[model samples]
Target: MKNLSLTPFFILLCLSFVKAQEVDISGKWTGNSYFLGTQIFTEYELHQEGNSVIGFGTTKNGSDSSKFRLVGEIKGQKIFLKGVEYVYKVGKGCLSKAEFTYSNSGSMATINGRWKGTMELTTCPPGVAGRVDLFHKKELMVAEPVAQSGTSPQMLQSIHKDDFEGTELVNALADRKYYALIIAVEDYNSPDIQDLDNPAHDAVSLSKTLNEHYTFEKENTLLLHNPNRSEIITAFDELASKVKERDNLLIFYAGHGIWDERLQQGFWLPSDATLDSKAQWLSNSTIRDYVGGIDSKHTLLITDACFSGSIFKERAVFNNSKAILEMYKLPSRRAMTSGALKTVPDKSVFIQYLNKNLARNTHPLLSAEQLFQSFKVAVINNSPNGQVPQYGPIGQVGDEGGDFIFLKRGSR
Candidate 1:
């Protein structure tokens, strides 16, 4: 007879092995890794076989870059890897270590860990210490696709103010160009909310005005009707792709909007947004982020929807619009909302006044500040509910006492 002992150490080891086998980490992991004040795009292509894993990490910046072979093992919920970092600057390898704790909830996968090593970049001295304490996630971790409505808006055509050629003062404004993205969502997929009137019509009317009156190249004016949340985001992304640092960008939206009283946040409801499915709603903070990411010298957001005022409460720059020449020298980010966190009628008195004022004004260049102030007075006088408009510069959003000048005849 042979005597066999089942020790506690062996029991724990078996449990760890079982846990590691239950979870699969056999895919790509990507994130931004920062070291020595430089951001490095990192990607790890990993393969898991039993409890052992092997992979490679590729990092690059401009012409400086390197790749490393990674070897690691999974124990319970933790992952440990070791490698040698080959620096482009030093032309030699240095020791590196990474430890991570991973989790997956259905399709959403995330891994957070700490990495320490030596990395020498072309911008750094020699033997620069590198440390990355961050999290990586599976790519394209977007929410489930929302139902789309209407046909996809056509891509904006590139337009240039070639009228500048051979004109005397055209040389003065030659360095500047104008771009506009106008969106209107008048219908909804959700039955809980009723469809609105005048959004799509208003967007069309505004687009025509911008193109004909403001010298916005008809090709460059992008007008979208009844766009989904993703389409709205993509519209901005496309606009950003084409604009330059010296250009001015204008965005206008007219649709259903909601405000979270508990969270003190506002959201722009897309055509597919449902009361039950909150993820379909686009937050104002996200719009702010997108507006900030644009490279244009001046950006203005005009919204005619409920809770639009909430977007600027915290980020309002109180300065008045500056002189034309001085304003052109500085940057500006401003907004004019229809109303605050209250119900806004579908008739859209805000845009009505805006259209009337801009159309009738004889000013060669109507500043955004002037348009906002005029609308505030007109909306209060006309709306039975006294839905006063809100206007201000976006705080911390690169407003520098400048104004968005809408050129009436393309010359000032």
Candidate 2:
């Protein structure tokens, strides 16, 4: 019958039916492993060399010296490994094992089986093979993908800054008038402070940077070094009065923050001030009240300090107090702090992210929400122990509208 061409046709069909599988397990993998129903987690990096795979795994205790190797062959859709060795450390003694497995899928394989092995003790004896399910995914080659386009012109103009020139981001956002007031307080005069050599800490250099990098409206930007409590109060009072007539306002503060349990409040310590004596000099409530009193439709308060929660309580009290009612009624306000209320300020990292991402535009562009999200991610990523940076709207005055851009086209 078709013997004249059957062999060639069959061979061609088989070759055409062979499909290549895609493997993508690369970089770092974080997952938990179970041994005898007890779970242990591993964050490992897998590297593939020809037909063999090798990598090191790190446990929660920060131990990562253990090495593992797997040698396998891929035949069509099946994979087979003859010798697989894993060596690791436990409480005292070291554990080592060699096993073999027949896998069904090369690209994606899961093995669920029992293993019986011998323990290395003085009287070594065979141990029961506990159940194990090892899951393997093919390694993938990865590269940083390009950012998507179609962003607004304002977003496109955002600058990128490291810690050294972070003030630029605030200026960039402020140029668009997205921010109403930008106040930076660096304590360069403190006797105990030693890092003042940084240009960021110098009042003159910082002010010059702000002036050259940003276009500020008259009386909108203030860069002070070790100002007294009275100066801060006066500035807030003046800024509040001016912003009460506008539709939106943005306020930013960077300095040392201290929490006093006795007063049940937090205070921003100026350069010349001490937490031991001036606990009441510049209370968080004072600033909150001033910002809360603005008649603007939207108000954003960004503070890089500790005990920021104390500001909300003060804002609430200020809204209900008679002091603010004489000049202006309270408006919607949103607040964000760089760290927990009792935590220390992450000044360099916080301001660096703000300056780098907020400044690329000549016009007001980024919404307060978007900027805060980016800042939060950056801070958390750079922080130790993966500590989460906390942020949320503080009081009832913040719910009128959700979107507030720091820069807008018109004068307030």
Candidate 3:
């Protein structure tokens, strides 16, 4: 036989091929599966070192974070990880195993697997607690498609008055069993009010429009106009008292919003509220406290006001961040404001663009994030002076996977 030497170049080529065939199942992944009668989606960030893997899982629920360890090997095209499960709120569960088939072709590798396990509850000690059976499967794919221009005009027309049909959005929301509250306030009581003649007329007209179009199946909506501070407080208190498990609560406020530095929070400037008297105004924290006190699974807070961003300040006395973050992490609560800190609220813009646009679109449901982006763009485009609204997750966006839309037009 002819003598042949294996050169370094050939050896390196073989090593490259082996590496290419190997799948690195590291980094962050979002998994969705139906478990225990609820659709549970979790975000897992994992790190693999040598033959051991460690990671944490954040579920759709607001449970405490969970830590997971995996010890397995890659055999041919299949990878296996087996170990005990330790969830934050739910403690050490039975031993679980994960099996995945990885296919490496080009830049991406597809991982398909199933995870079956029983979880324990750490919060409830001295008791084994109920067993949690879970199943997880994943598929690799390209990024989610972006909103396209093809859907933009259709969405825009949906929000305009010319094409708007009353109650279409409201009825659609009712079909989804969404309990929504719509509040419209037009205050003409200001000392510098130039529009004195149309105060009641404006309020009545807005109320009629909302009432004529929106319908609530759960009858959970509260519509108020020019309510005094005490009235607003009482209304909210009554609503807070009625919360139940798995309930969806929505608080919609449309009014003048002011930030009092002395109090260090925002306030919905009721018609009768005066800047001079601190006692007459309701603090933003007070509203948050009321909402937070409600033991509901989800809450949507929408405020349309100038300087509405002040409500989200980090140093407010009744810092809502804790509760907001908790509820959001549970993926149950969301909040949106019309303007940013120090930004002047454009009431006309909110109604004409934001609300109207939501009433028009029929496809590609808009999300809160998407709405914020579109609203910002629309405001800048329509305004004589370019203006942009400020928005961000009160907690983390990953927690709340669902999107919000006005039911009438299915536009978010």
**Which runs in model 2 stand beyond 4 Å of their true positions?**
1-179, 188-219, 309-331, 345-347, 361-364, 385-387, 396-403, 408-412
Better of 2 and 3 by TM-score: 3
Off by over 4 Å in 3: 1-177, 188-218, 314-329, 343-347, 395-412
Cα lDDT tens digits, model 3, 1-412, are 2334557667888987787456565555565534346545555445555545555444554452344434566665666665444423343233355666766556444555655543434122232222222222233343434567666332222333222122223322343434555555565465743222333333344344334443334355566767777788887777667765335565676766677677567777776766567676677777667656665555667676656766553312121233211222244445666566554434346445655544443432234455555566686677554444554434432224333343332232
lDDT for each residue of candidate 1 in 16-110, tens digit (9 for 90 to 100): 87766676666667776667687777777676777888766667666755666677998888888766443122243344677788776666666
| Global lDDT of model 1 | 0.73
Full ranking by TM-score: 1, 3, 2
lDDT of each: 0.73, 0.49, 0.51
| Candidate 1 colliding pairs | 315-395
The parts of candidate 1 lying over 4 Å away from their true place are: 1-171, 315-321, 410-412
Give the Cα error of residue 348 in candidate 2, in Å. Answer: 2.0
Residues 177-292, candidate 2: write the lDDT tens digits. 32245555564345653322232353343334334444444455665545667777776777656653334666666666777888787787666665346733577666666766
Judging by lDDT against the true structure, name the best candidate: 1
Q: In candidate 1, how many Å is residue 206 off?
A: 0.8
